[model samples]
Target: MAEFNSNCSTTSDQDDSIDIQQLMEDIDFDNVYSMEQEINEYETDQFNIMYNTDDDDDDDDDNGTIEKSVTLKPIEEQIKSEKLNPLSTTIVNTKKPMTLKYIQDEIEKIPDYLMKRNKVFKQLIYETLTTMSISTSTNNMEDLRKIAISIYKIMVIQTYQLLWAAYLKSGMRQLIIPSKTQRAYSTMLPIWPKEIKLLLQADKHVNENETYFNFINAQLHELDDQLKQNQMKLNIKANHFQGYTLSIQNIIETYIEQHLHCLRMEIEHKIELIQYDYHIQILKLEYLRHKPNTFQKQLMKELCHSKYEQETTEQEVNLLKQQITYYTSTNQSFECLPIAHNSLIDSIQNSQIRQQLFLQYKDVAKQSRAKIFALYMKTAKEQRDEYKNKHEINLKKMWDAYNSTSDNDKISSTMLDLMHQRCMKISEYIKCIYKFKSQSFVSNSKS
Candidate 1:
């Protein structure tokens, strides 16, 4: 019979048991051919055994062998072939990166002083521009542009300081790292090249020949002229309205006066009827009735004579005339009062007059408002000029302070630069922001 004994690397460890754990650990794709070879060899033995003594073979000799070399060279090669270039790795971003100024350009070599000066000026201009541009409308933004023109003299002086700082720093042999305070001034740093360009452009954009005050006055002239013309127009309107009101008031007064005169005359005539006319009629009737012979009796008869009828007739006639005059005058007064007041009220209520008055009032108000605005602009410009002058003076005062700290001026030197840069960048940002704000406002308004 054929011998069925099989040699295996890990098949002798257990009683008729093959450990799968050892197979998996020991086998890999690199050695799959070795495993197939072992399987074929086992099958060959099985076939031979079956032909020779298959019925006599015991279950104890039925163990299978597995050979896996665990060679991973092929897999390793595949992995190598699929590898990606390090530089080609995809980068994910949530938000776009903000633009930072090209600070490196300021320094051609390490420890370039221009870099520091650049930072300082950047800070100064940034602050100044921001101050100017924030919330400015197109109408108001012009002020910033004009104001930028006024900044030249100040700019020149600061430039001198930078040159001076450059000279001062030339004597230092130490590698400079600015202080914390100086670092704070970095916030005011301007992109010097960009700022200088913007400023020069803005400065030159305004005609070099135009005077500063002239620009200010030009802004004022149109507004002032309109105001003066409006004032004159308002003055005329006010005078006209005043005369109208007075005329109406006088007409009303005359009507009332005439009414009162009529009432007085009527009362006087009634009294005259009761007193003078009544007395005259009474005397005439007494004279007609008294004819007694004895003087004393005739006087008694005269005193007793009844003239009531005649007196009543005269009184009634005079009363009737007074009533007629009173009624006529009263009717005239009532008619005149209504006509006069209605005409006056009509004029008052008329839209033409009201509108004219309203327009005139607005004209007056507008004149004043415009004048105020003009004055405000003038004052603001003047104040700015004054402030700039004061700043120049302060700069001069700080010269000694600037000099006194020359040995340790990494801070002040940085401050001057930083402040200047803050001024410039702030100025430019202000201009941009103002322009954007104006465009947005106008767009919104149109919408």
Candidate 2:
């Protein structure tokens, strides 16, 4: 048991030693602590100027020159004044040797107020990096250095933005680049190293790129606004077109309807006139078909003349004498009655003969009256039946004409309605085509 316990203790110690080595290899605590200490020192202390060299302008030995000394109090005061008013700071000419310490000192010569601001900014950067570092598996030195440099570059860009704002607010037309040859009291020294120069060049390039991007964005926005305006105008135009089309269609339909109504009324009037003309022709044709012949008319006239002569002989004689005289004056001969007719007239004038003739005439009249009554009754019945049949036929003809006219009217009305429907459909199709064309045009314009 003692040997096993000893072996376990030895293994635990070896494991602890291995873990310590791994931890030491993974994280260089010394380097991190040292960097933090340098940052703190830089934050707290003011920059130191170690050496100053100026060319002497005195006449002495050819190889020898006098040293012009600078008072420390005045240098401190000047440096303080320069830190307070960076824009008014002037470049100082010196022959100072370039060194790492010298460069670092120059960079750390920021104003106290700016240094205070840097502390807060640095803390924020550290906090942000701490959060980002938690997600990563390992902290490679090179990767950490790159991340720090990138953060610093972003910070520098932000500082440049602030400086740019100040420059704009100052309303200065141009920025004068500092040079050794063009020294001025208001100008800064052109003593920055190659790295700072390169950084400044990069910032300038970034600013130019941003300016170009902004210009392009503004142009694109203008184009977009123009397109929207065009779309709105198109919409308004379409609306106006649609309204005009509808108004015109309404006008056309109203005119057509009015014209159709007038045409219908005219057709009805023409039909009535045609029916009246047809009825008049039918009456004229019936009168011609039933008209008396010339032979019958002559017989009726002779009977009436004979009845008149029997009723009044003296009036007949006087009328014949006038006719004879008129014929003689006209050089035309008159034909007298026959001998048998004269004997009959003399027999009628004798009383005895007239009495006998009267008895015979009475007998003949009674028999004839009976015969005439039978003929009159038969003719009257036949005429009444014929008249009834004619009336029925006329009524049937009139009913057939009315039905035919009504059917024609119905067919014409149906045809007119169909034409109207077709017209409406055509108009709707035209409207749809117009709409489709408008929509397609709009789509094409958009594309």
| lDDT by residue (tens digit), candidate 1, 321-407 | 332333234243322321122222234556775444433433333243233334333433443354345445544543544456444
**Candidate 2 runs further than 4 Å off:** 1-354, 365-381, 400-447
**What are the per-residue Cα lDDT tens digits for candidate 2 across 307-422?**
22222222222332332233224232111212112233234566775455434433333343234334333433443354345444543433343345454312233223322232
Q: Where does candidate 1 have its weakest 10-residue lDDT segment? A: 48-57
Candidate 2, position 309, lDDT: 20
RMSD (Cα, Å) of model 2: 68.4
Q: What's the lDDT of the predicted structure labeled candidate 1?
A: 0.28
TM-score of every candidate relative to the true structure: 0.21, 0.14
